[model samples]
Target: MTDQSPSEIALESRQAKAARLFSPSAARNRDAIGDLLAGLLPPSARVLEIGSGTGEHAVSVCQRRPDIGWQPSDPDAVSRASQNAWAAEMAPNMRPSLDLDLTRPGWDAGLGGFDALVCLNVIHIAPWAVAEAIAAASRTLIAGDDSLVYLYGPYLEGAATAPSNLDFDRSLKSRNAQWGVRARSDVEALFAAAGWAAPDRHEMPANNLSLVFRRRSPL
Candidate 1:
């Protein structure tokens, strides 16, 4: 056994705390999201997840689906740090987080050929252009007929928006004018423009929705 200095012990404690950052929403929705993904994704699939916030979802989902390889990414340095720390603790299937910004051009340049792409609670908090870019990139990266693009967040469905969702959308817009719940039809149109088929929407907990879009067969 090696002796440790007090400074070393303090540093170790701080590092440990930083590694285990918590997100209440992630904890609450991870199981529901995992169940949906398990049904949609194939065994041994390669999945790339965008906006992998606290990295909690990456660890949880990867652990639940050990056969699926997971790549978690975020644009924020702090988020990447948290994801890297979580990946270090999780199974080998979880890769270290990558630096990804949906707003940037060529964001998916080197990251292609994925079996699936997942973005949770992202679009509602980002500019509409981000959603368009994501759809465009998904079309380019996912090559297989069976590949999927999975998106999860609140959405406006014509005049059927829930009261809670309306409040949430208002709060989001107050934070950033560009950020708010997107219209489902508009989102579908984005995918359609990218040569993707119409999405299948599933109702999730807390008025959130899970949209699964598939690529159309080449003519």
Candidate 2:
């Protein structure tokens, strides 16, 4: 495969910015996400954020945590373009957007490594394969046990599901058979297979959760 020249990628970014988008959920939750990230990320951590819709959180968090280098990525061209624009306008420690599709082969190639990987509100919106791909990529992109994988989204945990979350899950499934909120236990087991310990879950606003999973040492 041919690597794109910087000029080419920039041109695409300009064109795609016309497709710039906004998400109510991102606007509503960005501050909360930032608050959590401020506490979780170590000084000078290099972070890679997946599914960075509209790049809102990236701009918000990176501005506050200039100590961290943040790389934001999205599979969608529109989102990627918008991310570039956002970074250009108000980047503190934000890098240009990356073209990453977790489910695609070679997606994580050439990514040196990261101190932490963050994915917000993505899994339930995508197929199960994407979640599997996240774990698979961790082996190469995240180096050691102290590194973390942070996931934030709605999940089914404990014995009972909240009514609102159940409704949201039904709505997601209706939109696409492959998509719906996932079970926490199921997600934990999947990551364990990829050498991560069970996540420490934090309650967030709107019944969502922030799951912090530490990478397990490679044997």
Candidate 3:
């Protein structure tokens, strides 16, 4: 095929810009997530956000906390492309989106340590192994004693499962046998084995939970 003309490239850019994905859930929860992060992250902290779909949370957080250095990443090409578009309007503190896939081997090879890791609405949709991989990788990725790993998603916690959550879990499992709401206890244990302290669970809107895990000192 011949190289596209400048007008063609410009048209495609406009189309891609118009195609940036927007999640209703993100629209509803971004402020809550941003408020939490504003308090959680230290000034000038380097935060790596995984599964940054649509980049709304990243932009919101960056706008709220200019002191932070935000790096957003995703595994899907479509999501990453969308991130690029959304991230454009963010402050200079926001880095270009990285195409990082935690499930892949050597996911953190070139990347150095971060002050914190943030992942929202990702775990339950992915296979269980993704959680294990992130837990394992986080151990090495954040070395400071107070380094944090923030994960947000629906979960089966102490109280009886909310009807909405139960139905959502069922729907997930129906679509993908490997996908379903995870037991909080199971996730706690998995992270414990990876040397993280028990997460401090924060109840969120829509029956979701924000689990904040702190890094532990090496033995």
Top-TM-score candidate index: 1
Instruction: Give the runs in model 2 whose Cα sits over 4 Å from its true position.
Output: 1-20, 217-219
- Predictions: Cα RMSD each: 8.6, 5.5, 6.9
TM-scores, each model vs. reference = 0.88, 0.87, 0.87
Q: How accurate is candidate 2 locally (lDDT)?
A: 0.81
Stretches of candidate 1 above 4 Å error? Answer: 1-16, 217-219
Q: 122-218, model 1: which lDDT tens digit per residue?
A: 8888788789888878877767778899999899986789889999889988877888899999999988898888998899999999999987777
lDDT of all predictions:
0.81, 0.81, 0.80
Provide the lDDT at 148 for model 3: 86
Put down candidate 3 lDDT per residue, 11-97, tens digits, no spaces.
111223564767778888999999997888876789998888888899888889888888889877777777777777555777888
The segments of candidate 3 whose C-alpha lies over 4 angstroms from its true place after superposition are 1-19, 216-219
Total clashes for model 2:
0
Clash totals in order = 0, 0, 0
Give residue 131's error in model 3 in angstroms: 0.4
True-structure lDDT of candidate 1: 0.81
Candidate 2 per-residue lDDT over residues 32-129, each given as its tens digit: 99898878887788999988878888887888898889999987777888888788877758898898877666788789678888998888888888
Against the correct fold, how does model 2 do in TM-score? 0.87
Could you tell me the TM-score of candidate 1?
0.88
